[model samples]
Target: MSEHGFWSRFLLPGGLWLFLLFVVPICLVLALSFGYTDDLGRAVYAFRLDNYADAFDPLYIPVLLRSIGYALATAAICLLLGYPIAYYIARYGGRHKHLLIAMLVIPFFVNYLVRTYAWVALLADEGLLNSLLGDVGISEIQFVNTPYAVIGGLVYGYLVFMILPIYASLERMDGSLIEACQ
Candidate 1:
């Protein structure tokens, strides 16, 4: 097959699919952001800069900074924790790689809200972990409604996202380079 024909046959459809799913929705949101809402909450489309102006107001500045800091911290944590696990799976998880990946992915099959509530159950003061610790004569520590709990939940929720890409890259890496280092 000709190069252009192959691209048109395969790549064009994929590109069109991405454009329809992502680009169209993003453009709609961009256009709607410049709109105003009526008393009934119906969107009235217009060209206005007030929304953008309000986004930078002093009241929101701290919130914006906090969000940026949180995002950076989350990304850093995900990378730090995910890269090693992915690398280990790619390099050392030979026969059981499929099972390992299945275990990682199975949680996603459950509802997100259910999984989050499950975390709450596991982290609550009277939760499973705390109860087990108490059984061994350890004092109970509060894990719920704390910064540690919040960060732990966020990390647990997003770690899979970080793992998949790192795993893909490691799996595709040349084994010869690793062997040469030995």
Candidate 2:
């Protein structure tokens, strides 16, 4: 397709969407980050560097760093675990791939917090894991309210988000690559 045609069709709609939502919001955040709030907690028209300076304060920096670290860890975990399942569903699970993908998506129909809490309940002490553990003489494993539980819940709940993208990429991938790789 010609560049003009491509832009007019694809980029036009996408650009409008990004401008209206993403770009505007990000610009607003950037603008607000340089301004101070009034007594009513509303942003004032006066411009200053205090907010940006405060963002780097020792009290907040550690937590900010931790969040970045955890997000990176989550990304790595998602890629490692989601790749194989995506490759499998896309390549081997032919004919029912759509149905299988749909099944994965069913969990999304539930609220995110609810899904996380469901895992919370399932992994809690005396919950599913402990009940199953009792069958093997190992009892009382704490899961809920811990970092382990949070990570597990995050991975389980968002697995579909990671999987769907990888799955789509794999599905659209040409089959000859598999033979080439093998």
Candidate 3:
């Protein structure tokens, strides 16, 4: 391969994609972060910092803390959760690999709102969880429209956000890497 070879040429397309889609969107977000809705509810463009300034107000700060705390916990949980998953699949999933991945994808292929509503059914007061609890005489485990319910939904809803890339990376893994890790 020449010093000026195909890898150099390959970088151009990926760079263009990043510039057009990824970089542009982030720039737009940053621009909007310093921006706001005017009195007429139109988006006003300016470099003022009120968007962040408002984040420090008493009413918003508690919600912000809760969200940030949850996000950090979610990320740490996802990493702890996802790593073992990808590793286990890569090591021992065997012939059911495609089937397992298909199961994950199947929920994603279903209507998005349908899944959320299904969870709604599962989490409702007279729902399946409550009924199961009654059957087992575990009557005090609270669910439905609570913080735990929201976290459950959010975790299930976003597992796909962590799953696909994990599958892809594991699927394409070098056998030698597993042997080395072992």
Candidate 4:
């Protein structure tokens, strides 16, 4: 086959997969969003804006704002925490760079749900941390069902993703150029 024909053949499967698996579902959901339930509770699709209007209703505005705030906080926390660790690993890891990266990535090998449950075990009112504090003559402190807990979970979940890319970029950079700029 010609070079163009060869590449197009390779692209065909992926294009079909994307269209069938991703695009079709998204289109269906988008179409359904402008829809409503009927008297019998069956979803009836139509070109309606009421669903969106209810989403942006005054009572829900605070929820939307809080979600946005939480996302921003999570991102900021991840950047602040991940950057320094990535910098240290890229700069000082040297002979142990691969090992350090492996250590960072190892947690992700466990199921995400398992790791989240581990956090719950550690942070719950009757959990390990509270037990440890009780031993030290401290009262139990609430850690779950709070904004901080949510942000911490978000940071934990996303920090490694942020770190790997930052580390890769920093590894590619010239250390001497950074020193010279300083």
Best by TM-score: 4
Instruction: Tell me each candidate's TM-score.
Output: 0.84, 0.79, 0.75, 0.90
Please tell me which predicted candidate would have the highest lDDT against the true structure. Answer: 4
Instruction: Give the residue spans of candidate 2 off by over 4 A.
Output: 1-18, 125-128, 131-137
Candidate lDDT scores, in order, read 0.90, 0.83, 0.80, 0.96
RMSD versus native structure for model 3:
3.8
Off by over 4 Å in 1: 1-16, 133-140
Kindly list the per-residue Cα lDDT of model 4 for residues 1-182, writing each as its tens digit: 79999899999999999999999999999999999999999989999999999999999999999999999999999999999999999999999999999998999999999999999999999999999999999999999888999999999999999999999999999989999999
| Model 3 misplaced stretches (Cα beyond 4 Å) | 1-24, 167-182
lDDT of 3 at 129: 86
Q: Tens digit of lDDT per residue, candidate 3, span 62-127? A: 998888877777666667777777667666879987787777678888888899999988878788
Better of 1 and 3 by lDDT: 1
Separately for all candidates shown, the number of backbone clashes (residues 3 or more apart, or on different chains) is 0, 0, 0, 0
lDDT of 3 at 110: 82
Poorest 10 consecutive residues by lDDT, candidate 3: 140-149
User: Alpha carbon lDDT of residue 134, candidate 4?
Assistant: 99
How well does candidate 1 score on lDDT at residue 118?
Answer: 96
